[model samples]
Target: MPSPADKLRALLAQDKLHVMPCCFDALSARLIEQAGFGLTFMSGFAASASRIGQPDLGLMSYGEVLDQTRNIADAVRIPLLADGDTGYGNAMNVRRTVAGFAKAGAAAVMIEDQVAPKRCGHTPGKAVVAREEAFDRIRAANDAKAAGADILILARTDARHEHGLGEAIGRAAKFSELGADILFVEAPRTVQEMETICRELPGPKMANIVEGGETPDLPHKELEDLGFAIAAYPLTLMASAMKAMVHTLERLKSGQDRTADLMDFGELRERIGFNDYYEVSSRYETSRRD
Candidate 1:
């Protein structure tokens, strides 16, 4: 497999906007790569939801996120970008957080300008740190790449909620000045606001199209026309999966679910790659017995 840097370089070279399906764990990451996605993101909301069995309320720890990053990195050949929430602390913490994710074999780490225990970007009652202090975090992240790790740094601004579109754009510009490789401005409410950000910032921008969020849905061609470098459709896969699982459970309770109604076991086994997975998993066990 090519190195993470090798894959990331290809992602950066694309003339069109690259799209990554956000994944929460190794199984999802593997499936995404097999499904032909060039990149995958370790989504903070999904990670917290899956890992802690709760909402994304800053409950997940730094080490836990890194562990998820490493697991996904090990399981897939494509580039993985993990969310580094608030860089795990202040500007100094941002330095260590960058190195930690790089050492974990991630291609990119996204840190927001928010205080610890921060809420989800789309959630209300959000707050941001002082602009000057937050920019320092970006500098530390740019400076803290592990040796030969080619890790990417994504600067995310949550200023769009408390502040306005103009403030978000201003912060994005400053983050770009502080050497952020990509700028993610959270929650643009309208297409005009989106277009303004694209035109205003000297940015390598990332667009988020989450269903039922603050961002209004636009066509792929429209998003591409707005100068986005990368776009992510997070939550769609998980939401669909969750709905199917719940419906299956309901059917089972009603005694309507049966082998005939279920998908073929063989087909599922093939899709999940059970044979290939066991082949890799068996090596250590067989060696130990030997």
Candidate 2:
């Protein structure tokens, strides 16, 4: 069977856009795979929100995200594209970050151009590092991947807000030149801007569809027509899960039974491989007894 990285590369070679849904945990990764998605994305925003109960303001450490990546990768057969915000530090740190994620089994690792302790792309007052620093970060990531990491490098630029579209495009182009497997120009506000980004960017482009974000929420077909190789809905599952949990909790507090609204216990157990664990246990028990 092809490795997850190979699968992602194959998907990129196709004409259609590959839609990657974001997953914050192992369970969500499994759900994404069961729903027939070819690939899944690990959003820093979602991970921070779920794991630390905080915003994606760079509170989570490299080790924290790496641990989550290992769990998610273990739960699904599909390729996982993880967010490696600012490569967790400088050029040397970027090298270590790439190696860590690769060792943790990420198919691709996305490193953005924002400075350390970066905020979400949609958040106000965001800033990017100098061009030289950004280039060094991507170069470090590319170098690490080239040195047998076996993971694709996704180079993202948050310069559209602070540096204008031209600079953002230039940075993406440079990142591609430096051997990034994918290019992402974050938070393009309009369809025209998205078109320009897709048209001008050199290689496989990624479209980040954040719910209620600065970018326009164009359909997959439109994104495909605009030359995007991948379209990532980074916040859909997280937002839905949050709302559903809140509603269920409120219902329970109001003396209502919301169990009917959830998956039955048996089905939930099956989905989580309880029967498989029991089968393994039975085999071990018989062997040990003999």
Candidate 3:
């Protein structure tokens, strides 16, 4: 299998921006792959919200995230890049971060330059570690992979808000020097800042396209032109799903969540691979003699 990093790097070297929707599980990954996208991302925001019912605070551990990444990777055939928030603490922690995710079948792992108990990049009032500290973290991740060539090390900086965009770009440049394959400068609030970053950063770059947040929607083509090789639309599917779930629950509480308001069971089944469900159930339903 081509590593997600390899695929991403190859795509970056090409003519346009690649759209990678964020996927948190096997089902979503399979759906994205079936939809014919070449890239998929595992977002910390979605992971925490879906699995743990919590914020993207550093509260989630490496082991917890590892389990989720494993399930998602096993569920799909495509390369997946995962969020390793703050490397779970320091450079040493990053060694295990790479090893764990690689074992779980992640094609790439993204570690951010944030303090412990990391918050989502889009969330307000974020801070970052020193430049040298982030550099060491990347070095440790790279070294730990140990010619695990298929696995990629992505360096992300939340420094855009804390230290300014220029410093973030400078950090990205240094991260590239430290052997990071991809750079994620989290949350540029303006198109101009984004364009400046695109022009300034010397290595491969990834963009976070979060609707209704610090990032406004830009046509994928425009971002590609600006030099973002990959754009991760984090939280689209999960956010939409959550909205639907809330609406459905509200309808039910109001005695309106009926078949008329919902898709037929057959449709629901089809969407979740219910036909496959029947085939498996049928085989097991019959006795050995039958």
Score candidate 2 by lDDT: 0.91
**Is candidate 1 or 2 superior in TM-score?**
2
- In model 3, residue pairs whose N, Cα or C atoms come closer than 3 Å (at least 3 residues apart or on different chains), thus clashing, are 58-117
Task: Summarize candidate 2's per-residue lDDT along 40-114 as a digit string, tens digits.
Answer: 999999999999999999899888999999999999989999999999888999999998888888999999999
lDDT of 1 by residue, 1-290 (tens): 76686678677777688877899888888889989988988889888877888778789889998998999899888899889989878878888899888888998899898877888777877899988878888988887853344788889998888888888889889888877888899889999998988899875788888899989778778888998888887777778778877888888999884566576888778767876777777878774464
- Writing each residue's lDDT as its tens digit, candidate 3 over 41-98 gives 8888888888888888876788889999999988777788999887887788888888
- Which scores greater on lDDT, model 2 or model 3? 2
> Which 10 successive residues of model 2 have the least lDDT summed?
281-290
Alpha carbon lDDT of each predicted model: 0.84, 0.91, 0.83
In terms of TM-score, how similar is model 3 to the real structure?
Answer: 0.90
Superior by lDDT: candidate 1 or candidate 2: 2
Residue 222, model 2: Cα distance from true site in angstroms? 0.9
The per-prediction CA RMSD against the true structure, in angstroms, equals: 2.6, 1.7, 2.6
